[model samples]
Target: MTKQLPYSDAELAELIRNGDAEAFRSLFERFIRALVYFGVKLTGDQEESEDAASEAFQKLWQKREDMRGYPEMRAYLFSIVHNRSVNFVKRRSMVKAAHQTIQAEGETHSDSSITTRIIQAETMVAIHNAIDKLPLHHRDLLHKIYIEEQSTTDLAKMLGTTPAHIRTSKARALASLREILSDETLLRSCIVFFFLFSAK
Candidate 1:
């Protein structure tokens, strides 16, 4: 049997443009963590970071055909996240100022905050329900990876498998979760809420 080589980022982008789901998955796995970290640095909020990263991926997928190569794709993804992060920070600041003004005027602003918390809680519940619907192994793998932030090496040791196997498992788990959370807007919101708050 001939051994197949891994695709380069450029090759993956081209394949993604051609409507290859696996190619898109490869690109997602390659850059998601780095983009999230960059977003966190930019926004200083874990939830906002996840939101920015998710938005970046969504924008990339939407414009896949326009991407010329790996460098351009990478730049575009980072740029999207950067803009989203900045915008989120600005909005947060405005909200904070509004809250302070309401408080100064002896207005009851707790209702708005309570509503926000309730929405977040509901999103978290939905995310957990979706995750719970996954196969047992996949659910466990996702929890360990995203919630516990376990290294593949550590997971491999615990599961009596190779690191490569753990990586493959993670990819599959992610696909399953994506399928279950098919509503893009809900998925984005739930993902951010779950990763930022539920994980802890």
Candidate 2:
């Protein structure tokens, strides 16, 4: 049987639109459990689902005037939580499947911070391979500048070249490395992966 919107629900919905806090509280108390259950069924994690439900209620408060009656209000809340759950799933999938694109090898670690986690071993290997593919002169230039931390002037003095030439070579080497490292899917996954962990 369909869940009918009671007259009391409709009355409270209108009251909330008029900025009545008591009525809003009544409505929240009435529907929060069902909303959380709805979210949990979709996300499979109670905490995340409840968080989504909370966000939905916050949105519904802001958008109270947009929806009318109990049915629209209930649907609106469910819609917001459902979209949140689906978008999160999509983001997780993108990162988790990063290796499928590179024909190579990767996590859901909550501590995946840049300051703490730094770069992964596989990412470092991929970067080293990309650098190795550069022209020998470009590779040596990158190594001296980045790995050895040589200033342009220092590099120039060692290589019997002007600092201006070393600067130009550094720019070219970085550009070449970027081209070699251009794996679109992997790059997208890394971005999503980083943000995902940071949110936790």
Candidate 3:
């Protein structure tokens, strides 16, 4: 039998545009690490780098049909990630400034409100840490659906799976996250925070 060759990046892009899950996975695996490294060098923050890289991949998926070739796809991914990292830095700066302003103002807020905000922030951090410990598929699913707010139907099409299966997998992933975030207090806070904020 003649040996078969791997698909070229351009070919993979075409396949991905046609909703080939394996091709998308191959492309994601091929470039995710390099993109993350690029983001880290630009942002100097590992968490932010991962977020930027994830967003870049999500953007690629969204615009798969628009990609003309491998070179354009590669350039687009890098550009998206770079912009995301820069925006993250700017958002962080804005948050810091707001925090400083709040401190300087010495505004007397209700203790309960402050406590709730602190708990929500801490719980969000814990949730992210737990997500980082999950398997790649589960982590990606959660981040894409929840963080990026991608539609389940779109993800199903991209992954070549049914929406029901995606929902089931997401349920399992959430169960695993709940297990990982087993602290009762934090879990309760996380649930409340998600319920309140997710409605918006």
Candidate 4:
């Protein structure tokens, strides 16, 4: 396919409106990373962010015919993925109480939401740093189970252990994580950690 990389989102939308697959692909490539990153910030799960991005693009394709009146396709995509990310979190998270509490706080004080977002980035950093403080095996286990969302059976097989052991280790790792997040220095990140470690 010829390069459509130089086209603006609006131009791409125009081309897509006429059923141009290359134009749609171009827009997808252009915004996919940004959307995934945005989704990650919202949902705190890389896999879910990717799923959200995919869903957003699918919606974009279906809604291409209605693109003419929209001011910015990028913004339109962001809006869709943002909603998708929230729904993803709500559907999958075991920490719905914390999520709802944060949402309520955000609504109670509008600018507080923006402040919450800024803290979210910090919380991610804090979580990673706390994870690093764990033993090597625990760190790896936590990454596989939580970050990669691996099942206990699969993770146990990979580690040459029984699923029971994996579950026990996971519990220990989570206890350690809770301890680490409880530090006063990492106060902001605690809620994000809660939002993330849902019903696994």
lDDT of 2 by residue, 36-59 (tens): 665565557788878987998899
What TM-scores do the predictions have?
0.47, 0.45, 0.45, 0.45
lDDT of 3 by residue, 30-139 (tens): 56766776667556898888888788888888888888877787778777876776676666667778755443322233657544533453455556567777889889
Task: Please give the RMSD to the true structure for each candidate, in Å.
Answer: 16.1, 20.9, 19.0, 15.1
lDDT of 1 at 108: 27
Model 1 stretches astray by more than 4 angstroms = 1-7, 99-200
Cα deviation at 122, candidate 4, in Å, is 18
Q: What range of 10 consecutive residues in model 2 has the weakest lDDT sum?
A: 103-112
Candidate 1: clashing residue pairs, number:
0
What does the lDDT read for residue 186 in candidate 4? 41
lDDT of 1 at 190: 38
Lowest summed lDDT across 10 adjacent residues in model 4 is found at 191-200
Candidate 2 residues lying further than 4 Å off, grouped into runs, are 1-6, 99-200
C-alpha lDDT values of all predictions: 0.69, 0.66, 0.69, 0.67
Greater-TM-score candidate between 1 and 4: 1
Model 4: runs farther than 4 Å from truth?
1-7, 69-71, 92-200
> What's the lDDT of the predicted structure labeled candidate 4?
0.67
Query: Any runs in candidate 3 off by more than 4 Å, and if so which?
Result: 1-7, 98-200
What TM-score does candidate 3 reach? 0.45
Taking the tens digit of each residue's C-alpha lDDT, what string does model 4 give over 23-50? Answer: 6676675567667776787778999889
In terms of lDDT, the poorest run of 10 residues in model 3 is: 1-10
